[model samples]
Target chain A: MPKKNLNKLREKIPLLEDIGKDGRVWSDLCKQYGVENPDPPWRITLESTCEVLNEGACALPVLERRDEEDKLSEEIYKDVPYPERQLLALAHSMIKKGFFREEELGVQMEKVYKRLSAGT
Target chain B: MSKSDKHDHNAAPMVDEISDFEVLEVAVRELCIEKGLFTQEDHNEWTEYMHTLGPLPAGRLVAKAWLDPEYKQLCIDDPVKASLEVGIDWINSMPSKFGTPSDYCNPRILVDTPTLKHVVVCTLCSCYPRPILGQSPEWYRTPNYRRRMVRWPRQVLSEFGLQLPEDVEIRVADSNQKTRYVVMPIRPDGTEGWTEDQLTEIVTRDCLIGVALPRADRKADDKRPIHKAVHPYGH
Candidate 1:
């Protein structure tokens, strides 16, 4: 085996399944091929820091999520993704007010708001 | 355009306003009351159960490990086994017969060394060693923190105000599976012959979480931006 592949294999380790696969999770599945039990450097990373807004007005995707498109000024978000059904109301309001930017995306509000009620 | 027009008195938006979680919370509470699974009084008891938790017990656990080599081995050999030494029974000590619903029994005590430092995370979910260490921080529960920490550990650590030496191996512990971990940071100087209580005082929640170094003078985690909860669970 080449040195580079060995290094790559080592770096591509999996975490979670703690107690290391009933106590030991070796780096590569191959490494565990021989060793009775190996303790890979137990690395667990928790997820946070999600993007609140993207290029589009995409927001309100979940019930538990903090929503209220009215909190921010109009035109800040356009064609926001209805993370929840409540956002559909907000999305309609944004469209009725002509708040969506159609010139850039070449999408008219009447057409897109049609999808909002369809419940995608 | 006006406040009165927004209410939609004819077709009130209240129906859609209620979240799934909110609906579930109501339905579950009602069912429990109806079926007598647990009374309203029992719910309050559980709420009080949460009140008795903090970093005190976990801090003491780390202190004892620092003081005794035998105890330290117990921490390394069997964390749940060693939990007994600190008066925390991994099994048969929670509301559940087996263990707490959220934080299960599998516990790992990561012993930090002079050349190595340890931190923990649960990228998929905020699966923490809650029975022992209490709840996780809001920041630790973020998707960005989870996704970036393991891949770019040094970068994340720096964000947490931890700049480690290149030689010092930074071992990241993901508490994603059954097992949950707490860092047993290396005992620092200035406390030559300190008692367990004194040592525990310094090992605040931050040290166990691997965000702050345990120090004799410091007995608490530094305050940061705390995004207030709408209906935060409080005593």
Candidate 2:
């Protein structure tokens, strides 16, 4: 697909927006994070392209956060390709565990970030 | 009578247009009865069950939820448990004590908040919540709908006349697994003091499917072209 249409397709799938551009971008990111290559990259391709057209409405901010916290999860995801279900399951679990208070997870994350930065 | 003008009084008109599907249906039904797989009474009872189903139960569920915050929370938290409030015992409602073999028991009610909207489509097949929402529409079962709705929900929803703001998070739930989903849209503004029954009237099938929004004035889905069947199931 053309770059413009590919971007359009990417908008629909929020999960893939953090992985940079194209399949090669993902492979390159994996290498940077010392992660194994996801052969075929079907999960990223299918989930990113086959999602509803949410554009960058929900993705842009989340991708920025992912980039900021890249080191935190580098070891966990170093050996496997990113799957959409895992993300969804994690979010649902977090919600259930009170990791998110109402709509603003920012408040909870801020407290964690402060505690971590203070080395306590 | 003259050779050209003579009518054949003893001859009968012959036109056989039965499709392969119809022929197979008859054969399989007769074979089942003969083999005692299920009696004719079972088939008739199932058909009767189908007749009793429609979108009313689902609509009532939504309506009841709108009226009561606790009930609404139950709908969002545990949809299967909430289903019982609306008279749908997924386990014992049908002949199978364990629930309908195909639809299963779990129901996921997608609650649309101010900033989020939800729609559902079975990417692999038409796996609908039949016990609550009744039969899946012909359009929902079409391969065209299944393929496009997941990819181009905005465009398809526009065809259905639902255009949401860009800020709204449009979540498309792909019902590929055992869980089935229904969209419980936030109660519209016009129904300020509406009763549950009145509110239920506006929660049409399309609204439940996330294709259309509920309005006090609108009680039915938009009209579409429907091809007549050779032998229609219901009048």
Candidate 3:
């Protein structure tokens, strides 16, 4: 078989920042629908990023923290409403956007665990 | 009474007291609420909406379609509109008038034919048609099912006790986008003139997901080991 040239297919996709520079369309849609417009573009970006990345791979993301988070989400939130998983995903995304440190999450988890165990 | 004597034998023993995941859920929900991402009311309302959801409406949609050819065509052409016939207004049913944030308004009914079959999987995350079909099954959300269902659909279906002929094509609808899907399997035999309720009863959640076919005898999905929750949701 002859070698196929793949240079044309390797063009760089525009960065999310560049793509989100003009937010008029999205803001208009949000306004029309009575939904709050996502402030930091990261809200949509993180979700799309996960979708794009997952499209190519057969398995879930292998990052240790992500794996643990997903496992926990499945164990605890599987029977609950879908928003629980959504919130967990959003939290991770916020962490990615530097809203909070992973270490901070550990401390918060401990506090929350104590409160929950105490039946507060 | 001794310390051991106080323990009631009838009560279930506590397993892992407050797992890390439980802590993380609380931490994340609290942090998000504190950050003003969403209020506790919004979360509660969404949960309540979820409680109202189940596979019945989807099952009815399939049954109605099976009985009426025009409705079946309508289901193929405009599924969101078709959903209304079964009393599921995809847009206005939930707390969010626009639709559930995760499961957007766009829902497509993948109608199975004699020669073709359809199944759904969200390889990225479990993006199910929750507004209509309710919460996805625990197994469906697993990475193992997500991965294998897309790659080796035949093998996966066989494991679910669903084996089709070689000539019949198996299509795995990867719901990686905003558009969700519910499989409408071809109406099964042994019900030539059955009522809509009778037909709906046979179209179990598994049939809607295209895992198991609707049979006259089967009223529920195949029995699988259910992972008992440490603190199961009452609703």
| Predictions in order: lDDT | 0.54, 0.58, 0.65
Clashing pairs in 3: none
> In angstroms, how far off is B84's CA in candidate 1?
1.8
Error of 1 at A8 (Å): 41
Worst 10 residues of 3 chain B by lDDT: B226-235
Model 1, B1-235: lDDT tens digits are: 4333556666522222222222222332333344443455545544444545567788998999889999899888988888877778778665444653255788888889999999887766567787787656656654556667788898877766778999999999887678888999989899999999899999988889887788778887886442222222111
Candidate 2 structure, TM-score to reference:
0.56
Comparing 2 and 3 on TM-score, the stronger one: 3
**CAPRI grade, predicted model 1:** incorrect
Q: What does DockQ give for each predicted structure?
A: 0.02, 0.01, 0.09
Whose TM-score is higher: candidate 1's or candidate 2's? Answer: 2
TM-score for chain B considered on its own, for each of the candidates: 0.78, 0.82, 0.82
iRMS of each prediction? 23.8, 29.6, 17.5
Clashes of 2: 0
TM-score of each: 0.55, 0.56, 0.63
lDDT digits (tens) for residues B108-221 of candidate 2: 899999999999888665678888998677567544567688888998788788999999999999887778798999899989999998999999998998988898789879
Total backbone clashes of candidate 1, pairs 3 or more residues apart or in separate chains: 20
lDDT per residue for candidate 1 within A1-120, as digits (tens), equals: 255532332231121111112322122332433323222111110001011111013222211122222221112222221121123223332222333422311233233334333433
Cα misplacement distance, residue B130 of candidate 2 (Å): 0.4
